[model samples]
Target: MLKWQWRQGIVTLFFVAVGLLLAILVGYSQPAFRSADSGSLSARSGVKIEYPVAEIKTGLPLPSDRTEVQMAAACLPPQRTPTALSFQAKLVTPEPSRAVPKYKPQQRQEKVHPTNYGNRMQRDVHHRRVNNELLVVLHETVGDAHGAISTFQTPHYDDDNQVSYHAVISRNGTVIYLVPANKRAYGAGNSEFIGINGVEAVQTNPSLASSVNNFAYHISLETPVDGLLDDHPEHSGYTQKQYQSLAWLIARTGVATSRITTHAAIDREGARQDPRSFSFPKLLSYLNQYPRPTEIPPCPLPPQG
Candidate 1:
């Protein structure tokens, strides 16, 4: 009976030892199972697991907070760049004037002379084709609009006596078209436009120096009675109406602001400086109202004789 009792106790001890071994094995495998389950759950939830469980167990350092933020930002949609058209949309539109008159072409034979202007030459005396780009040349008639018009009307057979402009704007904002746009008015004598493409001018007459008239659209603003003196530095500045009309006229031409220059700037003879007391900023303010035309209108053919 004692031997049997001892055998039973040994069996009981063996069972307990086997149970402990099984428990230890399960405990050792539990952490791995939990890690795999966590990874699966993160993937299912669309969470990015930057460091693998193996990496963490190997004691590798985790990414910094900033690195995590950068990663998050990288996942976001890209931002759009501001385009030129978008920027232009934000520009302020100028106030409408009280009396915005329509552009009128003066057809009177006295006002419109036949020989004062010529065709926009395709090539200069050097045989080089002038740039197709047109420049807006601002001028101030050194006298009243009527006087300027009269001067243009008078016949001048001599080349040196030739002087005209494409149009003239009175103080009341009356725009009188004199010479056709396709014709080169005798606007700038002994002048040149130093632009991005270098010196720009054409010598239509070998006797005269190169001039910007060949590729220039001349617009003359009638000088104030006070500004009639050539020596005067400035005068009672141009009227608001004049500024508005000038801006309106130029905006339609599709000529860029950079190319809009003064006769004073282009004149090489050093004797010309008519546009006195003009405010460029004021003109630009009004110009901003109009969107730049997509295409510049082709110059109409000159009236057939």
Candidate 2:
């Protein structure tokens, strides 16, 4: 019975040692681990160990600190340079203005001035043609001599090489010869003699048609005047010498004093007012003093038309 009691006592001591070890392990799990060399209470208990209870880190090779591992994961890796984006801005622009055309009118050229009236008149033909039925056409040159000559020399006025005005009176009472007494002068364009022949209804008073009728020998008288119808110096009338010369030429032409019509008188515009400052009464009186032997008839008044 004593031997059985000893065995029981030994088994009881083994169970107590196991319980103490389990209690020490529970205490270690509760407190933070201290160094083995620190002489901790756990180390003195003979149940504590220096080795780690569990592994501190897993995956990613992170440290025991969670804060450090999170900072490392947040850090980004280096990247390639970014491509440049297109920055074009669309803008509405106005179209260019169209060119405008300029309108211009065409120009007309001026006509040429006539040169010679009768440059081709032969001497025989000019002298042989004597116009007995005299129809004198008197002309008074108002402008300069150059203009007068130019007018008389124009071909339009003297076509057929037979332009003949018996005489031309200059401003200074100078008489110019265009043709001799024997040729038909183209002095009158659309005209007729009133005294001797042609229509009597067209007949004007002898004194009125005297200037034109005096061309019996186919001659013309050129008279000069200081003024025309207006009778102003600006109108350019005849000088006293020119009037006297005209009278002399009339007397020489043997024109009856009764038949001197101005261009206006025969043309019948009622606008025919010439010898504006001249006295017809005085001229008649002078003519009365120098009478022609032929019996003078009453002058028929010019037709109004």
Candidate 3:
């Protein structure tokens, strides 16, 4: 009876030891919990999960493209602040002619068709729903505006060669409308916009990488002739007229100053460095002249199946 009791006790002890070992092994296999402030996290099934960080302010002027990381951080959230309207302010309304700068209405060559662009998307590459928030992506044509126009006018059946912009501003401040604002322009490839809402991008085609083109309004400024060389770092800078025209066009869109970004800010591939030698303060000065619209038209909803 004593031996049997001792044997029972030994068996119980062995089982307890085994259980503890198994528990420790399982704990080791599981991922450790981390704070939300850290980068991204993944679930057991391998799905990536993102945590919201603080909102990043925009429209602050920076000197060089090296600070793109800060610029790409976040877009401005919609503001609810009421505009101060005093009696004098209401009485002195400017005429529409004086507010908006003159622009030329021109169409791309017939060869540049719908194939070169796509419709703005309501969802992202993952088919996940996203806000169709409009963003203004500033670009610079490496060559003359006519040269860029010619390239856009040429047929590009190949996906790699396909490129276009909603509008192009010449050195003389002539605004040439290319693709319609409602359509997606092939501006920045492999690009993404990190805003208060989180990462924003769309992959319209499997062959192409994700980009912000779906919700971006692309506007390219023609490079000065002296700065046409690919190796040149900076040029004489854009004309005052160009700055005024850019600000004028953007103001009419009703997009907030914070949503305005440069190509360098969104490019993920690290190759783009356009709209160089730009003056954000100058643009802001002109933009301040226009009153912010009370409401911007929302994107049309996707068709229900």
Candidate 3 deviant stretches above 4 angstroms:
1-111, 293-305
TM-score of each: 0.60, 0.39, 0.63
Score candidate 2 by TM-score against the native: 0.39
Per-residue CA lDDT of candidate 3, range 159-258, in tens? 9988998889888887788887777789999999876446867787788898888778899998887789575667878997788888777765666666
- Which pairs, if any, clash in model 3? none
lDDT of each: 0.67, 0.37, 0.68
Off by over 4 Å in 1: 1-110, 293-305
Q: Considering summed lDDT, which 10 consecutive residues are worst modelled in model 3?
A: 81-90
Q: Candidate 2, residues 1-305: lDDT per residue as tens digits?
A: 88999999999999999999999999887644332334354422445332221112123332232232232322312211110111011111112143311211121212213332112122222243212222334554444444545555555632333233546555565655554343334444334434322231111222223223223222222334434223342443455445545554444444444345554445433443433445455444443434231333233232343
Worst 10 residues of 2 by lDDT: 80-89
**What digit string (tens of lDDT, one per residue) describes model 1 on residues 49-130?**
4322211221222223213322332232221111111222112323344443354322222356776888777677878654
Residue 59, model 1, lDDT: 22
Candidate 3 global TM-score = 0.63
Report the CA-based lDDT of candidate 3 relative to the real structure.
0.68
Task: State which candidate, 2 or 3, has the greater lDDT.
Answer: 3
Better of 2 and 3 by TM-score: 3
